[model samples]
Target chain A: MLDTIRRLVDEQGRLAVAAEAIGDNADLYATGLTSFAAVQLMLALEETFDVEFPDRMLNRRSFSSIASIAGCLHELKEAA
Target chain B: MCQACDSFLDRLFAKGVLHETGVDGLYGRGQAFEAVIEGMDRLITRLAEGDHAEVIRFPPGMNRALFEKSGYMKNFPQLAGTVHSFAGSEKDHLALLDNIHNGGDWTGGQGATDIVLTPAACYPLYPIVARRGQLAPEGGLFDIQSYCFRHEPSKDPARMQMFRMREFVRIGLPEQAASFRESWLERARGFAETLELPHHIDVANDPFFGRAGRMMASSQREQALKFELLVPIESTENPTACQSFNYHQDHFGELWGIKTASGETAHTACVGFGMERLALALFKHHGIDTNGWPTSVRAALSL
Candidate 1:
């Protein structure tokens, strides 16, 4: 799930460096993942995983890093 | 961003149209700018007089408690500026003076006041109208203007820490509010055209906070709840929003318990013009020299 989330970030995020350059807990915003790109990633992730991100789960911390996104998605899946 | 724009700023300073106080995003307007602004205010009054709006004046500083209720801090925390005052004993005062003497953080002793500087002109009106109970059968219209503050300070002349927003707000049924927003948006477009500004209207949103703000912004766009009239003031590539039309869709009405004649939550909408931005747009398009402006434009502006 972490690898897949990292792959998605590489494909959709507006990152300045390759996904491989970032660690699992690296700060995405510090690495230049913009809000505009986050929305695009969110839409793609919702479609890819068939899991809708609820209002309570949609925040900067949720998309702060690949590890955090994986964590949130895992929680969402568990609840679902 | 161009030499011409910078040159005009200089000219504005020279001609007393604008006075720069050595602080970024803060300027003192001279008679010329104020005159033009007054004329524009008259123009707005004329255009909206037919609507018979009840004019309400809100002091620039709003009640801090009421401001807290508006949830402005939740959405635009970065831009919110709270009014703080020094409320300390003599010892604390001596310490504050000592800190200031040493050029340290003297503002730490300052406490929050009963007021916070107004962030938007329409914010104060919501609570005021809500307390009035149900609207009359014909609904309600309000005209208000205030000096609004945002914490973003920049050298860009268009982006100011303090500016004026002249707003016309309507409250009633959902369809009434929606149509009022639509109709006024066109009127605003026409108002820009009268000044011969190159303009465009597009869906826009308030700069929300953090990651959650991005989702809110996207949802706002998808739902088409807000729109902005963009004009080239600082840059043509990235036009500034000089005027905005917004439909709150019962957000404030529900929060404030404002009911309609039918005993339902009344929807609210507002169309506001950024007085300074629009003025800058006019100067950009017509050049800093108003004498060189087209006769029709001058006649329309009554300048």
Candidate 2:
């Protein structure tokens, strides 16, 4: 999970600093993660866990961080 | 204009249109509206078949900073809508209110917030996809549709402040991107043909970064790259661009760390249909009384 967060941070470059400033659960959208980038992350998550994230789970909060994403994955897996 | 087209336009105008703030004269009822809706319904039914199972809906708005990073503001600064905040003392507020009441210039000292209306439906999907790891060999696809907003302030119903966009996106290898886009082109063409709408396809280029956008636009004409599905709804002279197929090589993947199962950068492509524009096109072609329309076409759209 940390690896995933680190990778996302790396991919974001300067915006990752903004994410760190506001803490983990901070609104990543506010920090600088564009809608385009957010979608890319969602696609990556689906590929990683081989899970299909339901329409309800696709939102800013779900993609907020590594921890939030992992939590979503856990829920999706258990529901399945 | 046909009588049916006029009635449809009247009905649409009768219903008060809700438009985004600062964007006026861009939407309303017309033959274009009817045609666009009909066309969109047909396209949705045909595309919502096998392999395009998942139906995803995205937020109508987007993050402002993200837009800045995506170069939307830089590329189309004229069409960008910024979210802003008012942080002033009581006296400042009162003064501003007075300015407004007195018909004075009130556009001053507005601090920008970190949010913006989503310009495109597919943009918000990228970050969501990137959160997961690389895709497996076969790749993945998503069907997303949303109400997208743009700041084009044209009275032409075709250039709306807010409009519907349905997109089929694929993330995988380069070959997969090409194949996905090519398949969509065929499907879109067939779908349009069913509606008996005159359409054509051509290659297109994205408004690239910096000085390159001008060169790219010129080159688009030279190469006939970007194909637009044009229909004469708003103006007979200028056909509206209702749909487009875009191939974003590794640009998005590189920006968001999208990778294939093999750990290589993935290619992305999307086929988008402008639901509103298509609807308008349909209304223009077919009369307002959809009940009298062909049974098969009506059944296909579930109308």
Candidate 3:
């Protein structure tokens, strides 16, 4: 799941730093992920994991870092 | 104009500051009102003089194709206004007149024109800058003012359907963009002080449309991308936004292919003065009569 999140970040995060260089707890926004890019990442995550992010989950905290994104995905899968 | 309507809107009309146009949010500004707008514009110019910003004045309408590419409709479809014109043959024209004569919907034949009302003063500038290729090593700064249109109509005098926005836009690296917004945020407060207007700066979000937009707005606020300097105009409890400071990151630069001297996508920021709203705030806080205003406030506006 961590590897997949990293891969998706590389693919859709549009971060200034390489996903490999970023720690799971790194701040994605501080590393240059804009709200626009975050939306792309959200869409990509939803498709890859077959999980729809609830409107309540659509916030900076839910997508702030690779670890947070993995945690969110885990919750969504469990709920599914 | 109401005979005893104590609302500021009615007061303005009674004082010959505004002329009612029958529409809720549309009104004609009398000479006194226009003079205040002019003074506010000059004050903004004086404040930005040291920046040596390139000045560009665009008409209220912008290219429809460019407007589509702007993603404005996607964000705020409710506020978007498109220009439409009657494009019909002689027979269609006759049918249109007949429909109008019958008091029917004659506007059905109107087609969307090649123009859309410009949503913001800086909307047209980005594409123009992109066309010029890479920016200078110092990046770019511009002074722009335009009458912008938003579809929301309200009885609030400050919330006009058509309004003037004066902006100073900066396009460059992230730090450059952020610092530009930071500086202007402070400068704007000073401006309010100079104008003797009670104001406060706070985090703000655009009125993006729909359920998805709520999330977008929260994210925007979280990122601290937008801020507004609010002043009491229509309601003291909920002050009207008189000035806005926004940092667009690399959104426009990426969309319009604008680049810095180093060939990276340039970030952008803008500080916008809601000219009409500020004028109204000045009148509300000080008084309708400019001569009766505080000597310092009048001196600051050079009124």
A1-80 in candidate 1: lDDT tens per residue?
87778788989996889888899999897897765577778877887888989887665677878888988899989999
* Model 2 lDDT tens row, B1-303: 344555444444543322224445345444534544755655575666777545788777777766666756645666667777788889989988999999996678678888787888888877778888888798879888887887776756566877788888899999998888888778878787777777776655554433324433543444343567777886767777778887777767887888999999998988888887776676566654565666766665656
Sorted by lDDT (best first), the order is 3, 1, 2
Q: What is the lDDT of residue A70 in candidate 3?
A: 91
In terms of DockQ, the best-performing candidate is 3
Which docking class does model 2 fall in? Answer: incorrect
**Model 1 score (lDDT):** 0.85
The pairs that clash in candidate 1 are: none
lDDT of 3 at B127: 95
Order the candidates by TM-score, highest first — what do you get?
3, 1, 2
Q: If you superpose only chain B onto the true chain B, what TM-score does each candidate give?
A: 0.96, 0.84, 0.97
- TM-scores for candidates 1 onward, in order: 0.79, 0.68, 0.89
Predictions' DockQ, in order: 0.12, 0.01, 0.43
Instruction: Compare candidates 2 and 3 on lDDT and give the better one.
Output: 3
Q: iRMS value of model 1? A: 6.9
lDDT of 3 by residue, B1-303 (tens): 444558888888888899999998788998888888888888888988899999999899999999999989878999889999999999999999999999999998999999999999999999999999999989999999999999889989999999999999999998989988999988898899998889999999999876557668889988788999999887889999999999998889999999999999999999999998999998899887777989998777767
Q: For each candidate, C-alpha RMSD in Å? A: 10.2, 16.6, 2.9
Clashing pairs in model 3, backbone N/Cα/C closer than 3 A: none
Model 3: residue B62 alpha-carbon error in angstroms: 0.5
lDDT against the true structure, each candidate: 0.85, 0.69, 0.90
lDDT of 1 by residue, B231-299 (tens): 977777999999999988777887788999989989999999899998888877887777788999888
